[model samples]
Target: MSGSSRVLIAEDDVRLAGMLEGLLRSEGFDVEVARDGQRALHLGLTAGFDAIVLDRGLPAVEGLDVLRRLRDSGITTPILVLSALGTAPDRVDGLNAGAEDYVAKPFDIDELVARVRALTRRASAVVPTVRFPGGRLDPESRTVTLDDDTTTALSERESALLELLARRPGQVFSRALLLEEVFAAADDPGVVDTYVHHLRRKFGRSLIETVRGVGYRMGSLS
Candidate 1:
């Protein structure tokens, strides 16, 4: 039971998709559904999720294409392919296309839930801790530890923003880009400034740098 873990279900069968959503929700997982491959790809790239359940017969982009694109873009989220193409070759193709697990159609709902839980557990176990000048950030736990060893938990947005900057220190990121990628096209760009201010107050004023007439970048952790 991956309590509160987020999952994306890219399934086209309306009845099946809705059933899966209700199942995952009852298991205490946060779930989002995309009825087609195009929307699936968009959410897979822009949003963060613990696991993904993708259907091979998706319309618009096809499931394997979507899986390849996500992998090519460096998205490491665990994906389980669910489809009626249950042949040996089909299973091989799904696995070869970067799916962590493959579940054929007519799957037992309980079994599907178990596999998803396993994927989330494995992903959480392997997330690498990011180290910076004066601190370290844990991606799985969303916690930061300063040189003084004071640990603080960050909200999802805060952790995402800080991780983006810290991962590419000194690289500038514009507010528009941040809104699109981090906040998933938030209506107000000012939200970026608000989170930056929150991070500065929690960590320090110098934790991030503002680029005049441009955007923001990682600053000296001091």
Candidate 2:
């Protein structure tokens, strides 16, 4: 949290992102702006940033998904979810998705900067990988192994999506939650189905079951 705390601003709004960037710069924190979810994800995964200011309505990938993916991949950098959806549910969802803190939009730049500093100042904790029936999913490695014999690797998005379903085997995830929790808000809802399809192919057609107009869930290993 010194003059070297790097911050990533994942917001699509040109003006807001820029304003936040300038504010962080003035505060002596190294700042980077990612205008869309793709760039956000790319930078977030490849770069070593200290803290993140994420917008829920990110263009290509929703901010929550980015947060979820980062957490899923063992990137426990401090994160603050910044968005206009300040409803109780929205705040809960963002926090539940893995953000260390949540800041609603139209926020005071000074306050936002303070929160970012607070996040970086806090001590970090290690999040362990998720375990499911007949397999172990190591988010840090982005790999999954089923049946104790073959280990299958997943792509960035695939790993995030599967990690969501894998975290709770019997719990059904609605398409809306999938979009909010795993995919970008601007991303097509059908993208959930597509990823499910791909997961089916990778984990087997029966590994993920469709809930008939509801959503998808991790299928029973038996």
Candidate 3:
């Protein structure tokens, strides 16, 4: 692959998740993992990823439910469901819930890789980014540059948060929701506000709009 695919693994099985991560990394794919469904949904929604491998059974939220909600939110990223149930109905249920492919547990690693590659091949032609009048945000590089040709690097959390808001300019994201999506419930909601403040200093106060009691939104990039 000329470019590595950003893949998310939302499996509760720690052993399996580690193995998958190692295998995917070895294959030149950028991989990240979530131990439960909540983290899966958050990271999947907020970050820019090429494809997802979702486990049907997960804690905090079920994998199927996560898939459904992701689809509902208009995120059309390719998703492959991993499940122990491989009955006709099982595959049907997963497909009906918006999974692009279904793989029963105990799958061949090589086959899994092939399936993931297939999903990326069919991924939609949408590249996520946020641009303002004089600056642009690059999700992959985690950097932002302004009109003056000056650039600033962003922390992982900052990049994720900015990417999410930039993808939907003018859409106000509440602090709590931002925390969940960007920090994955691992950090406090205050982190959202703190990062917003930090970004304002770098990108200008107007670029990141505060929604008063609500959350924040990307200012007019045009």
Q: Which ranges of candidate 2 are over 4 A from the true structure? A: 1-3, 123-222
- Candidate ranking (lDDT, best to worst): 1, 3, 2
lDDT of 3: 0.82
Kindly report which residue pairs in candidate 1 clash with one another: none
Q: Which window of 10 residues has the lowest lDDT sum in candidate 2?
A: 123-132
Evaluated at residue 157, the lDDT of candidate 3 is: 82
Tens-digit lDDT string for candidate 1 (19-96): 999999998899999999999998887676889999999999999999998876556789999999999999999999
The TM-score values for the models, in the order shown, are: 0.63, 0.56, 0.61
- Please report, as a residue range, the 10-residue window in candidate 3 with the lowest summed lDDT: 124-133
Instruction: Compare candidates 1 and 3 on TM-score and give the better one.
Output: 1
Q: List residue ranges in candidate 1 displaced over 4 A.
A: 1-3, 128-162, 165-222
Top TM-score hit:
1
Best-performing candidate as measured by lDDT: 1
lDDT tens digits, residue span 102-182, model 3: 999889999999999888877645454455455777777889877677889998888888778765553678878887878
Please give the CA lDDT of all the candidate structures.
0.87, 0.79, 0.82
Pairs in steric clash, model 3: 132-221
Runs with alpha carbons beyond 4 Å of true place in candidate 3: 1-3, 124-222
